[model samples]
Target: MPRMLDVSNDVRAEIGDEEADRLLAGDNAPGAYDCTSCRTPGNTEQELTSTVLFVGQETAVLAFAHATCVPSQVVPVSEDQLRGAVRSITGEDTAPSYAPPVPAAAHAAAPHFPAPAAPPAYPAPAPSPASPATASHTSAPSSHAPVPQQAVLGVTSGVVLVGREACPALVVEPTAPIVRPGSPGHGDEFLQLLSEQGFAPVVDLSRPPAPNPGWSVLLAMGRLHAVLMPAPGGGRPVAWWQAHSPMPLSEGWRGAVGRTRKVLIYAAAAGTIGTQPREDQLRAALDRAAARGALVGASMPLAGT
Candidate 1:
């Protein structure tokens, strides 16, 4: 029987046409699956299903979601989490059991993070809240500009999975309530303002945010500087949020930017997402914000000094 599977080009490219065909043919696809995005039961034979592949450092797990909920794509995650997800979906533990150690000769052929004699390039591991980060003064390019009460903007750096890559992301939040430029009372309208500027609500994190042209996150000397958007009148780009003092990027984040050369920017109203000490925590907060419609995001090309 044929399944209503939607294997996107990105997923097809990674899993190869042969494997994708097998899935489409129902040889490997599950008849009923718990949609990874919405966590609801779905039948591939009845409705369109998306094949979401979670690729970790070592293991890869294939999961299914509603195509209406999220498009088929690959998401990069830690090996442990990947195994846990596999267990949840398959109802069988995926943890590695005891096995005989491989011979040293074979170990030499093993593939790992760094190649032979390669430098250790890791980032997003050193969770630091006392680092040389910055607080910035940014602007909002909205016809409905908000009046910042404590308008001081906070920028947090982290890496998020978009498709098959670990891409750099910035979370921007204000310190206090932001209202209309001449509002009489305290009310948060940050998300509304950003919507007018092209940011989209994040219904699912598995898919990348919508592209936001004429806006970008700038880094100078591998340091986060500001988020620039098209000027209101038209001369040079202006800051939506400009770091008063640029913050240094981690080796991992800088390397990711070097490879992808793009950044995903997410914003929430004041107090929606606080300063999280770790990336995982930050991701969790973003998830909560997204669930409640407090999150807005845009994928912008990288900009510089």
Candidate 2:
């Protein structure tokens, strides 16, 4: 028979005062709560709930009860024990909340801005002709042709073009993703990409470290933001992006293309970190970030690349 996994520590740690009370109150873990004293289940007869009493910063006591369970049978638990149980069961830390003092000067000033101008009614340009014979060319072409055609190149160009056309319409707003320093595996690479894209990468290290098994990265472009985290099967990180404002794509991101046109190429060159990411996944993540007025990009190194 396969050896049973050790759950004693996990159980002990996860069982907070509240959870313990619930357990004693015969609150169903999900379906049925068992009564240790009378061998009776609680939730079967009524709903069960719990209340928490914070004793200190790191400790809390909990009380639990089923609608049918007697008030006299409730058990008390310490905050430390309760927190430990939560960690063991969920593998997540309970974050503490801190309130910062507001600046006095911020409230003293009234906001001011220039008056808005009337909207322009410019006519749309006619479509360009494919053949030079029917086209009126005002500018001379550079001696060198553009970069060779490649699937990755095409994808990057498309992203840049979208940003350029959409920016002018006030649709795209540039934003950056929040990243923690010293995260394992390809975090530096992700940061480098953001810097190249003209974003000032900010690192927040105030919180305790998490068990980051695989690589994660964040990127942002105007109105494009993304957060890429590790997938369950441990391949490439998943990307999530969103747009921050409601504006037409054609005008929202105008003038941004020149700065970002080369970014996708660099990201593609970086390739997928760990296991290669699927094209759809990357595109989806980019789209999410772009929509949010930020961009989050990440790359994992393949073997020998």
Best by lDDT: 1
| lDDT agreement with native, every candidate | 0.61, 0.24
User: What does candidate 1 score on TM?
Assistant: 0.52
Off by over 4 Å in 2: 1-16, 20-28, 32-192, 195-305
Residue-by-residue lDDT tens digits, candidate 2, 271-305: 32111133334345444444543433322211101
Model 2 sits at a Cα RMSD from the real structure of 22.7
Residue-level error in angstroms, candidate 1, position 264: 0.3
- Give per-residue CA lDDT, model 1, range 1-305, as digits (tens): 87999888866766678888988898878787665543446899999987766555655666776676556766444454454455544445322211111112111121222211110011112122543332223332233343544355567778777667788788877666666455676767667767877899996777879888888665432345456676655644555654434355666666566667678888888788887766767778888999998899998885421
lDDT of 1 at 89: 49
